[model samples]
Target: MALSLMLRNCPKLKGLSALSRGTFPVSRHQNFTQLVCKNRTALPLAVKCHNQFVKAIEPTRKMSADHSKLWSIEKLFSLILLGVVPATFICPNKILDNLFAVAVVMHFHWGLEACVVDYVRPIIVGPVLPKLALGLLYVVSATTLAALIYYNQHQIGIGQTFRKFWCISGTPADNEAKNQ
Candidate 1:
């Protein structure tokens, strides 16, 4: 009844001579059933085609091994240093900035580690340390790095801060500030 009212109110449809011929009646339930049947018939074939395409492409895909073997303790330490050093020395804000910088570095490191464990490490040790341990380690490392950065920033003085923080040190602005 509502649909008929809507169709009646539609000025563009009212102007059409074909629509004025008569109210064309059809069963809504029958139309819906026809649409569902059409989609149902097509669905399985569509899924089969997609599965075939995926399978065909899967064999040709290559794993990226750029930092494949760089997962030792020394390398992890270096990564930590790379993240922490810049934040501690370079950032204008002390505690929070340093912590953020360290967190950013650790985040990338952890992500790379996770990818390596999931893809590369499976080929080596058959999923070492369980999934739970891996997740726990990531969370712990991130938290620890954040806390360490905050601690270091609070403990250190500005003069002892590394100049490596700014790409361009000893600029006119710095020199002017120093001169003052």
Candidate 2:
């Protein structure tokens, strides 16, 4: 009777040990199959969405390519040389320089305008102040350029002039103390 009990208990204990050891593998298999099924179900939906998006953008992509090809390499180079080189080197009155400066400032202003229009809130008060400030800056830059042209025809001492223009208001002692 004891032997029968011992034999029955041994099989139960063995089964319990086997179950403890097999738990992780059985759970992992279940999880893996669940993941596979989820991915299989989602794959077709993702592919269909991607196809639809590509189809929607196809016409725009072709239009952009066609527009981009309008400016040939030779034409672009010629435009750059004609616009930039004479502005920097050949013009003696600095009119081209002033025009270039104004153009750059206007370009910056337009870029800021585009950014504000695209991303900023129409009712937000913060962007309005910055836009006004940028306008003031453009005016100041243009005025400074005009003053430079009026006062100095030759480029002599221009570096010294710039240094003086940006000179700090503090004494040399204050600069030395700050450096340390």
Candidate 3:
């Protein structure tokens, strides 16, 4: 406690404290930290500019209501997915089939977006690549959803396709037997 008090009161002693780390007791580290913080040099211009850039681009959050609501919506999407997938497979209603295709495609798009956001982070893959990757993911997801909806609208339908997959016995003879 005496050494800590000395460190707080004397600026000259703070200089000597850096050289005596091996001899310094653990209790005095807090005082030493304050000395270092108080004596820090002005940051470089590049670092100062970076801080200003970050401040301008990303303001401090006040309450983040949008962030909280987004999390709840993600969970709600999950619950919808849980209901829509099995229901599509079990019963072959045309309306339910169309809903399943749209809902599941949306769910997959969100899931893939999360993966792209995580793996293609600007820090790791460079700033431009992450944005490009995200764009590409959006294109692919749009194409997939369009194709699924088109198939559901113009062909045998999504539900019947899934039913055929579920009921297939993996042999031409068995398929023919079932068809007849």
Best by lDDT: 3
Residue 106, candidate 3: Cα error in Å is 1.7
Q: Which stretches of candidate 1 lie above 4 Å from their native place?
A: 1-91, 118-124, 128-140, 157-160, 164-180
TM-score of 2: 0.28
Root-mean-square deviation of Cα positions for candidate 1 versus the true structure, in angstroms: 19.4
lDDT of 3 by residue, 48-117 (tens): 5455555544536465456677678777888987898888878877787778877777788888898998
* Residue 163, model 2, lDDT: 50
Give a tens-digit lDDT track for model 1, residues 1-180.
Answer: 567545534654333333222223335556744644655654454455556555533435376865546456446656666666566554535654555556555666666567656655443455655565667667877777776576556755332444444335677799788769
- Candidate 1 clash pair list: 90-165
Q: Provide the TM-score for each candidate, comma-separated.
A: 0.31, 0.28, 0.60
As for candidate 2, its clashing pairs are none
For all candidates in order, the CA lDDT equals 0.55, 0.51, 0.70
Best by TM-score: 3
Candidate 2, which segments miss by more than 4 Å at Cα? 1-39, 43-125, 154-180
Candidates ranked, most accurate by TM-score first: 3, 1, 2
